[model samples]
Target: MKPLHARYPFMAGAREAVQEASVDLAEVVATDEDVVERALERVEWALTDGTVGDTRRQTRVELLSYPVARVIVSTVDEHICTRKYAQAEAASAHERFVEELETETELRSTRQQHLSLDALLAEFDLGTAVRETGDGFRVTVGTYLELAADQWGDEWRLVNRSLVDGEVPVDREELYVLLKQAIRHRVVDGLPLSVPDVIAENLDEEVERVRETLSNMDLTTEIDTVVPDLFPPCMKHLLDQVQKGEHLAHHSRFAIAAFLTNIGMTTDEIVQLFEVNPGFGEEMTRYQVDHIRGDTSPTQYSAPACATMQSYGDCVNKDDICEDEINESHPMSYYEHRVEEADDDELTDWREGAGEDGDDDSDESPD
Candidate 1:
């Protein structure tokens, strides 16, 4: 098996490599212990660490494990699990590609086969769409829209970028970011594949383990009650920025929106919260908030974990409650903890007075 395929098993070339090798996927899963073990590691590490775990030394094993891992994930058949696996795989590939790009030209060649930036772009048919200028690159508006995720932050939004003609300017770092999203889209495109009965039966144990891990990681919080005062520091910070008509990064917006959605705020209420923002557009705001609430999207996301919040520089003003790693590792968990500790008298139901002042203002007759 090619080392390049092992490094980027999501690439179409890698699938072609496997097909050319005439590898029998079902037979590999049933008979190859190393491949099966590596496959299990791929899924498990993805769940636990947001990585597929390194197995670079065993090229064939690593390459074969990817398909086996897909089998196991498909057999498990959980959307969240599937999403996490795809994300982790995409992330690992992004890191490797970035490292290769940063390597000196002479040194990169000496290294085992690796796809150059131009080659990688060509592989995805982005050659014409992403053109390098003297200072940076300008991506075609069409390609930019297809790859840029609003979830990355405000910077990725078309309105927030410099548009020249029909192209949007992006620096090297931004191009890499788009490529990562491209990899993720490719990886997740045909996911939850239809597994043959033999392969599914062979992977039953791995499937069960993945399910168990998913259960533990399921961040779904059922908070039918609304108490804004109990919001975690990160959520509070994001919400404050929104109410003050300050610009919020996309990740921050997502963190707060997901946290609120999980904590019983309807899409309308959430949209109202952001109406004061300078960049607010009623339709887009409603659509984004609805997307986060899963009213208009396929995936229902929970508030990011504390680590993720910190990663995007969204985590701020950690109080004593947040300092406790045991209980407050996630914004939703922190909110849940605070709600549990709060007495009824100390909690204000934000829902009770929500939009009432606006309603009153509307009802007032013009004198």
Candidate 2:
């Protein structure tokens, strides 16, 4: 078990700063209660950039005792580690906050797969048994359902605005939507909160350390800033979603990483790009990026076809660029044509299949 200072050396200078903030927490929280968000902004840069493959430091995130560490880590862990928030990655001497995503809020539930009136009743769990009727389910007052029912009529919180103390018929679609919301709320609000102000200087110092670490990486590849604009719309959309912290479907993620590797981005740069995503996990991102780059094996993989992107729901709202007649084929075909048009100066470092083969070393694709 590494101490906090050993795990996060940038924290050394910030300890005094955080101690000061803890003492003034009441005053700070009174004015700017959103210091929690401020803490998250800097902590994210620290965690993601500082410890990419360093398992020991990453594993020690559980021991951090800084104020607002819980909330800040909560936001980052969900995306960076893709797990429910842990106040500490391990059990804490303080109150242990266990955010089990499955029992809390599962994206897919058994109820969701096989939904039926009778099945719904068995699981409705309004803090009591669901009273069934010939017309619909009965909702009595003094039940948890009452809180959900209060928002009656259109724009109601509960699915059925027709909820009543006696009996109101339920729509299957409405019931499903209601259950879905219930699932989301648990995940969204399950993060633990701290009562006092978090140290700003500590966060700033940690963020600086992360920046230094990234800047020092020996990235030899050069990617054109304009290159992303030429990506097929499905790829562009997937990139947009991840950059905005949205999680990608498996195919979209694989497709984008493969496409980037083909277009002259190095493994490190590609990994950094994935770090911006909400579902970023160090091990998973590293494994996938390496696999796509052919660092793991000799298999050369190509980006998925346009048809595959459509199947993943990524190729939508065909932007003007995506609709171009020239790029109607596979994503790699689009890159192959566009690179040929780039200035020879930019292509000075280029080689055939370096963009699509995922590395300077080339291997023939099975396709």
Candidate 3:
């Protein structure tokens, strides 16, 4: 969104030059209109009276034409000079002249600002090029005949040959009318026209075809119909579940049907609810019904397979032991159990003898 002046510095100066030139031209034209008129009259009188020699007469005519021409020429020259200065002011600016020219050309072409066929003919003295072939006529500009001959071979030959040989001759007025009709057909119906008769007939046919198509189209037909009551209750419920952020392993359609069946949802009511709920669609509800009932019907499961645990034991471990606790009376019991049974008996005998000796000494001293 940068301004054109900011992006292209040269354009800024060019624009300023254009404005100055325009103002200068306006002032000159306003003040000197009578002078220009007088000059023109003088040149005209010279031409009529033969008062001057041929060279002087030509010079007078050139002088008379100079004012108007100079306005245009000087403005353009100033614009160019300003643009060069602007470019020098911002040498690092991106190269945009070519791109701008191309964009401008495209816009002008699309807006039909380019010279019309008739205008080109008048301005360039270029005639319409055409050719003859067995199929139809091919018409193009004189300069484009070679390039257009391929795709429009038959039509080109027919039109060109007819025009050249004066077989289907046409005057300027007739040609204009025919050209307008052809252009209209090409623009509106995408139909190519080679001859005037063909153009008229094809245009009519294309119009009729379009009318027929429009008449046949039915806008009221239901392209996407939904049946709510037919959807299983579980499927509808699954829609709610999914909406609530619960994940499902299998297709929700089967799950929804199963859930509905489990909750005693009738086929008719399930379908009705499905129809009423904006969240659930008929296809999803159908899928749920198929999934829950082990229904292998074509309508049951449309999604790919998913993994799920069928029972709690399927995912539980029965052999796991608690290693963080030890018996209070036998902290080393676990380690002792790892010892040989014979070694354990010898350790117990030694502890018992030590307990008997301590008990005897305590009994004698207390008495």
> Which one wins on TM-score?
1
lDDT of 3 at 356: 24
Candidate models: Cα lDDT each: 0.78, 0.45, 0.32
Give me the runs in candidate 1 sitting further than 4 Å from their true place: 221-367
Worst 10 residues of 3 by lDDT: 219-228
lDDT string, candidate 2, 1-367, tens digits: 2343323222322345455435454344334434433434334434344221222233223222334444444323222221112212221211111111223334325323322334333433542434556664544423324323312233332332344653334543343434433332332344433322354333444335434543453221212222564565666777887778887778878888777776656676666566666668768877887887778979757677777777876667665544677765566656555554554335333221123323232222111
lDDT of 1 by residue, 19-39 (tens): 999999989988998999999
Q: Order the candidates by lDDT, highest first — what do you get?
A: 1, 2, 3
Q: Candidate 2: list runs displaced more than 4 Å.
A: 1-226, 319-326, 339-367
Give the least accurate 10-residue stretch of model 1, judged by summed lDDT. Answer: 358-367
Best by lDDT: 1
> What TM-score do all the candidates reach, one by one?
0.64, 0.31, 0.15
- What is the Cα-based TM-score of model 2? 0.31
RMSD of 2: 19.3
Per-residue lDDT of model 3, residues 20-119, tens digit only: 5453433434454443343333222222331211211232232322232222222222221222222222222222222333365557566423333344
Q: How many clashes in each candidate?
A: 2, 4, 31
Residue 29: error of model 1 in Å? 0.6
